[model samples]
Target chain A: MFGFCADPDTLGNVAWMACYLTTGKHMAIYLSVGTVLLLLAITAPAALAFGFAGASAARSRILPLSWLGRGYIAVVRGVPDIAFFLFFVIALDQFFEWIRHEVKCPDWDQPIRQGNDFVVCAEAKLPLGNAAQWVHETYGFFLAVLTFAIVFGAFAANVLYGAMRAVPRAQMETAEAYGMSPRQCYWRILVPQMWVYALPGLSNLWMVLIKATPLLFLLGVEDIVYWARELGGAKTARFTDYPHGDWRMWYFLALLVFYLLFTRVSEIVLDRIMKRLTHGQATSGGEAQRKAA
Target chain B: MSCLQTIADYGLRSIGIGERLLPREDFTLCQQFTLIGSGMIWNVYFGLIALLTGFFLATAVALGKASSNPLARKPSEWFIFVFRGSPLFIQFFFAYFAFLSLKSVSPIFDPFTSAWLGAAIVLFLNTAAYSGEIFYGALLSIPKGDTEAADAYGFSGLTKFRKITWPTMLRLAWPAYTNEAIFLFHATTLVYFSGFPAWRQKGDALYYANYFADKTFNPFVPYPILAGYFILVTLVIITVFGLVNRRLNRHLPQESRGRLKMRMNLIR
Candidate 1:
């Protein structure tokens, strides 16, 4: 990244450190932070949408739809979400490949599950066998995103459902008296008013989502945790230019500091958001706002 | 082999007692159920011990946070902040590496280096912080009237705390505490994934599930079985906590008493 980074091995002290920090692997580490942020940006709204759908379905008038929604919420609530994360990535991958296999290989006679291997046709492989290296990485990242959305979506659903219920019954009655339709009341009154209640839970969820980004490494994405482990391991002279003893402790410490900083910033932002959401509202924060104003 | 035989062979497999090698090929429903069910022993072990131990520490931390002195208040506040601020996954890795380094420095601490001690300590501290926050919230929300009534009756210090404060705190915090307990159980799945290495292939449910997934290259069987086992464990936790919640509220009149509603808010 700098002109002085030409010879990392020959340079001494500050120069060596400068070159080492700008190595290609370090660039990947920097990029992985972007990956974590991108994941948060994408998954937040996606999970919110999923949660909205879930909350709505749970409140549906139809018995089966309501049951289906309630069941979805209940099941996810009961199990450890990491189990779902581990389950869904592989299950979804196989489900996709199996679908593709049926479509792409009509003449193939061998069973897809032969003994231990999931032998999908070559064309049916996710990202395909011939895809670029980036495709594979991106595919894994996408799966991680999906897994995150699904797990956190259930949590968001629980929060949003509670928030939706917390919307004053009298307000709904007033909307009815005004001759507004159920849908209009839902969209205009309930949804708008619910944000004040939801904001607290949603902000908490955002912190959790931010913290959860490291689990992307478990999903096979070369995330910050992956990079930390890769870069911080004892590098022998046989393997690389800079040989060092096991520095995983330091790497994890760096990750811990990074997360602590991220969460602290998030706390500040979420507090501001709560204040904004509560402005002139009837909640406790709103009372403070009124007093200040 | 029959289901009974499968159970006998793999029931203690997670503890490294049964089959030398995990079933690799020609997987069956019985095998999936048995092996995953066996793996759940580790999850339950981790959750129960952590929750049991964390409960007391959480109470203390909650009290510390609510203390009049800044000396008590500050450390409790920082403890909650540090643990609650970071992900449990990172906490596990941070803890494992920290323990590993400590083990290198002093071999006498090898017991602490193992997953059982290391992971439990992390979980204990993690859950304590989370539950401490819940208890702190409950403490703040304790009715002023109740405390004044206790003061009016000449109750002071430990007597005031025992008679008026602690019970109310427990009652008020019970619902949120239930959520924390559930999440803590869920967090046990993370133990093997963190920096801690499983000795002799002894690990939690997700670890064994991952093992089968890798071996079979077919995730369908093992993962669901693992999920089912967890779902059962979760149900048991809910039932037990619900019983405790009921007992906590038993003193109040039926109309005034809060029901033990299972709210799935993620505390961890």
Candidate 2:
């Protein structure tokens, strides 16, 4: 990162620290922060879409759709989500490979599951056996994002379901009186109105999503946690320049602070958004605003 | 081996009792159930102990946050923010590493590096912070008239708290606190997965489940069994908390009593 980092062994303490911080592994750690942010950027809206679908389905008058949606929400409940994280990644991966095997290698005589090993045909591999390393990493990350979206979507559905219910019944009744169909009433009235009600819960879920990014490490992504563990482990003098004792505590401390600040900033922003949403609304917040005015 | 023999061999395996070596291959349904069920002992141990110990600290934290004194208020606020803001996953890692360093500093801190003491401490602090926030909200929402009534009755401090304020807070906070308790128990699965090593293969339910999944390369079986155990634990927690919630709300009329609802507050 700097010219003084040319020879790490000969560098002064501060320069050595700078070089160490700018090393390839450290760069990976920094890049992995971007990975965490990218995951949040992608997962938030994806989960919201899933949540909206789930909430809508759960609210459907149709019996099976409602059952499907309600079951989606209920089953994810009570169970440890880490189990989902662990289970879905493998299960989804296998499901995809199995599908690919069925389509691409119908002639393959070998059973996909032979005892403990799940051996799909070579062409049926997720990224294919011959794919670049980056493709494999991206495939893993994609699986992770999908898993996150699925799990958090269930949570969001619960929130949105409540928020939809919390919308004033009079508004929907008014819509009905105006001859709006059920679908129209839902989109034109309920969807827009539910945001204010959902904001608090959605914001709470956002914080949770932010905190959960660390779990990406468990899913085989070289995420921030992975990097922190990798780079912060004690390095022997024989290994390379800038060897140091265990610094995992410090690295984790940095991560803790990063999360703290991220959540704090998010809370402040969410508070502002909530204030804005409630500005002219008929809820208690609006009532208080009117009184203050 | 017979099912009873399997149970007798692997039932207490999680606490490092009967089995010297985990079954390696040709996994049976019986082995999965027995081993994972045995592992639930650790989960129960972690959750119950952490919840029990964290309860007192949570109350203190809640009071501190609600206190007017900045000296108390600032630390309490920060404590809640730090613990609540960060993932418990990170907390476990940070704590494990911190304990390792502490262990190096003095042999007296040796046991702190182990999951039993170290992870429990992290879970303890983590749950305390969460419950503190819940209790603080309940404190703020405590009806003003209730306190005025207490004042009129010449009650103050500990006497007033024990007689009126505490009960009201617990009653109000019970539903949310129940959700927190459930999630905290769920959060216990992350213990062995984090930096703390599960000594001698004695691990939580998720640990055994992961082992089975790895051994079998079939997540279809063990993960569901693990989830089933957790669901069972969740039901038990709800029943116990529901009983307490009922006791707390006993004075209220049947129609006016607060009902337990499962609000989705996923992850700490």
Off by over 4 Å in 2: none
Q: Pick the candidate with the highest lDDT.
A: 2
lDDT by residue (B1-268, candidate 1, tens digit) is 8889898899899898988788867778888777777878888898999999999999999999999999999999999999999888988888887777788889887988788889999999999999999999999999999999998999999989887899999999998888788788888989999888888788888898888888888777787788777667767877998898888888889898876677665525
Which residue window of length 10 is worst by lDDT in model 1 chain A? A1-10
Best-fitting candidate, scored by DockQ? 2
lDDT per residue as tens, model 1, A117-224: 789889999989899998998888888888888888888888899899998899999999999999999999999999899988888889888888888888888889
Q: Kindly report the docking quality category of candidate 2.
A: high
Looking at candidate 2 chain A, the ten consecutive residues that score lowest on lDDT are: A73-82
Candidate 2 local lDDT, A217-260, one digit each (tens): 99999999998998999998899777899999999999999999
TM-score of chain A of each: 0.94, 0.97
Q: Could you estimate the TM-score for every candidate?
A: 0.94, 0.98
